[model samples]
Structures are given as C-alpha cells and as structure tokens.
Target: MRAGTLIATDSGNTLAAVRRCEGSLERMRGLLWRPALVPGQGLLIAPCNSVHTIGMRYAIDVVFLDRDGRVLKVCPALKPLRMAMARGARQVIELAAGEASRLGLLPKRVVRWQETLTA
Candidate 1:
C-alpha cells in the first residue's frame, strides 16, 4: 500500500506516517505481525468502523473518524485481545499507544492525509 502523512489539521499536529489499508487483504493484515509500531506511524483503514486486536502483540490507540475526517471517538491504549467499534465511524486510524494523546487526536478533531512521493 502507498504511504503518506496524516495530520490533525485543527491543531496542525502530524499524527503519523500512515499507510492506507483500503482493500480486504491490506485491512486484514492491519499491523498484526509487527513487533512494534514506531512513533509517528499508524494504519488508516477506510470504510471500517470496527477493529480487533486479537492477535496484536502490543497495545494501540484507535481513532474513529467520520466521512468528513472528523473524529467520532478515541480509544486509547487498547490492549491486545480486545475489540473496538464506533457506531457512526466510517473509518479508523490505528496508532501506537499514547500517540493519540500526544498528537491531540481527540474526538471532533479533523484529520487530513497528504500523500508522500516515493522514490
């Protein structure tokens, strides 16, 4: 999948170096086998309202977003073997633990993505 930077436009915060997970295969793999997610890194899964961390090796923070890129909810430090769902979320961003707070990705915040030109 192509990568880019996700920013919280409201606070001018750079949320993460994100990879878009749009297709079934990409969404399914959603950080499952990664030993750890580095700071400033995350996965943006579109058209997704629910996520499971059943096999994840580490905790993560989840931000549920609407179609307009507004945050509907923020689930922080979600431990392994758990699931999170937002009723009206159209997409979700999964970040390393505490990355949400650090970036001020709270509910109602707006998120924007800028594509990175890969060499």
Candidate 2:
C-alpha cells in the first residue's frame, strides 16, 4: 500500500486511520519510534519494506499489506519487545493495538486503500 491511508473498520464502520509505510530502511529510520499522536486523516509515508522492533508507550495492532493493499497478516495487541514479520508484505501499518480484533481483521481479509486528495 504505497504511501496511503489505512482505514480500519469495526462492525462495518471505520474505526481508526493509520498511515501506511513502505518499510524501507530510510523511512523506518526517519519515523519516530515513539508513540505518535496522529489526527483524523493523518498519514505517515514510509520508505521501507517492513517495520521492526517498534517501541511505543502503548501497544498497537499491525497490519501487513501487499503491493495491492491486500491484508496479508494481522498482529493484534503487539506489545513492546514483540516482533512481527511480513514475508509477502510490501508495506506495514501500525495502528492502536487490539484495533485489529475490534475491526475483525483476520488473515485472508482484503483491505481496501483509498487515495486521499492530500498526501
């Protein structure tokens, strides 16, 4: 999901929005490893191919997406010191942990990515 917004749904309604990252080494290094206060419609474009060793004050749900923005893997409540790997993922989105379960996101579930007017 190249530099786009990730809309998580709960009960068929949008619950949270997370910026999609390409998971490049440069992008990963550029991103703040701390908890971020992103507003509604916020987005963080990443340059890498995956995210690793995320250290934040709170746990977050991670969604691994393929080149087509398809949901490849979902790791709910990913706590600090925990690691999630996306073998076939081209991008990874970090959302508030447990958001995945609340959104009923599971393997094989397809996530749709809509391009915003602004980056």
Candidate with the greatest TM-score versus the true structure? 1
Model 1 worst lDDT window (10 residues):
7-16
TM-score, predicted candidate 2 vs. hidden true structure: 0.64
Give per-model TM-scores. 0.93, 0.64
| Clashing pairs counted in every model | 0, 9
lDDT for model 2, on a 0 to 1 scale?
A: 0.56
Candidate 2 error regions (>4 Å) = 1-15, 21-26, 29-49
Residues 42-87 of candidate 2 have per-residue lDDT tens digits of: 2333323455545555555677777665678877766766677788
lDDT of 1 by residue, 1-119 (tens): 77899987877766689988868988888889876887889889988999999998899999999999999999999999999999989889998999999988888889987778967
Per-model root-mean-square deviation over C-alphas: 1.3, 4.5
Q: What lDDT score belongs to each candidate, Candidate 1 first?
A: 0.88, 0.56
